[model samples]
Target: MELTSGIRDFALTPDELSGFHARGYYGPFKVYEVDEMRRAWRGERLRLMDREYAVYRSEAAESGNTNIANYDRHLDSAYLADHITQRRITDRVTSVLGPDVLCWRTEFFPKYPGDEGTDWHQADTFANASGTPQILWPDGAEEFGGTITVWTAFTEANEETGCLQFIPGTHQSMFYDETKRMHYDPSSINRKEKDGVRRGFFGYDYRQLQKDPDWTPDESQAVSMVMRPGEAVMFWSTLMHASLPHAGNVPEARMGFAARYVPTSVRVYPDTEEIEEYGGRVSLERHGSVLVSGEEKYSHNRLVDRTTRGHRFVSN
Candidate 1:
């Protein structure tokens, strides 16, 4: 869909871009016409039950009950895909990354009420098929090779419900070596106090870096991103961010969708023919379709694909 002529005039201002460049992330950007986007999200949620049920059964059968995974539950659904590619979203992404952008992948993160929060980590830590390291755009212009991550809030996100957080200005640096970092431990809860040190997700366990004489900042300071429904936050993939645990007793689970976009000029992994997130070696290009806008083409990835069926959950 084409954006309205006035849409280009709605792009972020220089001051706003500067804030993102200095802070590493920005927004609660007033993107979608709030009411309309909210309605669209609710419609998508109403259809989620059938999708969830089908996924549960399929996943259980494929991996056995012990190893079941729900990552692909939303793929192929028209409702969800439309929301991800909505014109309001694509325009903002194009403004940041320039005309040529490809969506590499999209994923839904449903943090159940009372569920533990995700580990603090940089998005770049997980490499896409494109082996290139994620870039940071301090200047918010095309010259920096910047990528845009648009995270849409499907449900109300706040501190009580495990909203996302980030360390301002942390994305400007290169990725920390994972070899020296700690592996993720799902069973044991991370109870470390934020001591003002700038660390990304799983930075705590990486002992060698922790012991570095130069690494003296406390690791406890992070800015949480609490947003209302229909509000979206955009961040560079290299930004150091993580979500807090859900402390609310809300009957419904917290749901959010993330879409990753990069310029088309970036080379995707060549070995993989098709993108498979579950268990196959797939390339980045295969994961998402390319979004061509004017002179630019952006890569579009689906974080959540809709399913044919839905599931119903009894509120506890």
Candidate 2:
């Protein structure tokens, strides 16, 4: 794939890097002009619905469930494939994850009018719902391993539209055990309230995985991330994060596309053949991690050089 020197831009400065380490998050950075993002989304959204080249082509994936159906569209949509490898996103990610980084996964999070907010939670192994370790790090590495998630706003994200909420510095510790089990009940969705807020973890209760049943996230420490269309934020996957419920004051739904990144040393979906979660299942037969930056020193994960439609991924 041809690459441009522009990919070298957007690296986090020293101060920004230190702040990210201290706060576990950074930026409502601008990735695209608002009109540019809106225009792109308008066209891409229509193209994405086709899904002929998507890796997870299954009945369950198209069943209207929010989970599997909204995953890895980058593998099919050229626009989304380019979005994931955008220098604005990958440069900042590599700033934190070192030179060699891989775009392991991507998912679309949409909050419709009156839909319940995402329950506050942190993920390490990412097995909270699937009961399978999604990412594994080698021994002698950090005590905990988590991917860097870059969440870009495709639509306006405001207080009424259910913007993301984060508790600073919470990435250093685990409040919920990923190994713990969380029951999935689709009927429970948008039907429960937690600490007086309407929230649910997709179809599961994230509270079920709490290390301490009585423990609660300190709302006093939480901050809302209000973003404009084309804005993006990067945070550690283990950061205590959630969102507010859409108040239905707006006509449009809030859409955030999250691209997950990890160093080449980390294994993506180690020993997994299929993903069964959120009451949906998809095979990994066509799965491949996109090396977004630097070299791939590890062979533990499958790598794809192009989108299923033959769009080349931008990489050095």
Candidate 3:
């Protein structure tokens, strides 16, 4: 397959990088070709809306407010895989995490109108579930196990339609306690409630954390990330971010896709033999790792590859 330069020229500038470092995340960087992305979006939406493709809808309030509907290798149809693997994205990651990199996973998010927004949370707390070790950088270290998350907007992202919001600089901390999964309660406010602000599924109880002498929100500041169709924002895995609720009056839903990249050196699982979920303990090795980059190592275990088979794994 022929490869293009990807979106390097459109990469985040120095000021943009500074903002991201100071804040935790940044951008609306134009990644995919706009016209091409629009075509892909229209085709995918038609397939879903017309029942030509199967979609999994989240059970009410079980897995947070957001309902994620996905269609995979459809990315191949848009040549997204080739573009993503290009030097631009990979090189930038190398600059941060060093030479060895491999894409870990990818998924599409189709947020229907009136769909609930995701609660604010850091990605690292969930890293354990992926079988990847928690990465910590040593003092004065120039690089770490950099995981780049590329979130591409298949449609215009706006506050009215549940755009992403991020809390600046919240990623450089330790994992939030995962001893118990909190029940979803829309009315509950995080005790460190900045001016009574209502943010979604921040795993831990902020009220309790506020009392801990070492805990802080990590220089918190909330800002909505708006992007036009085809643009994307890439952020580190541990960044504190969440999406706003879709309040738009559009007839169709908002769609976005997130592709996660990680270096090959990171050991996926360290101590755990298996993880228990949905009344069963599943082996992470059996599921294997998701290939979002490199020489197209496809897997039936992944949502992207499964889409090619016309089957989806939905929780019973």
Best candidate (score: TM-score) = 2
Off by over 4 Å in 1: 1-7, 32-38, 46-75, 128-146, 178-221, 273-286, 295-316
Per residue, candidate 2 scores C-alpha lDDT tens digits across 211-306 of 899998999999999999999999999999999999999889999999999988898999999998999889988778887888776668788774
Task: Write model 1 residue lDDT over 19-58, tens digit each, in one string.
Answer: 8789877787665665876788777666754533433344
lDDT of 3 at 249: 83
lDDT minimum window of 10 residues, candidate 1:
307-316
TM-score of model 1 relative to the true fold?
A: 0.68
What lDDT does candidate 2 reach at residue 145? 85
Error of 1 at 184 (Å): 6.0
Task: Give each prediction's root-mean-square deviation over alpha carbons.
Answer: 8.0, 2.4, 7.2
lDDT of 3 at 162: 80
lDDT of 2 at 196: 92
Which stretches in model 2 have alpha-carbon errors above 4 Å? 1-7, 310-316
Pick by lDDT: 1 or 2, better one? 2
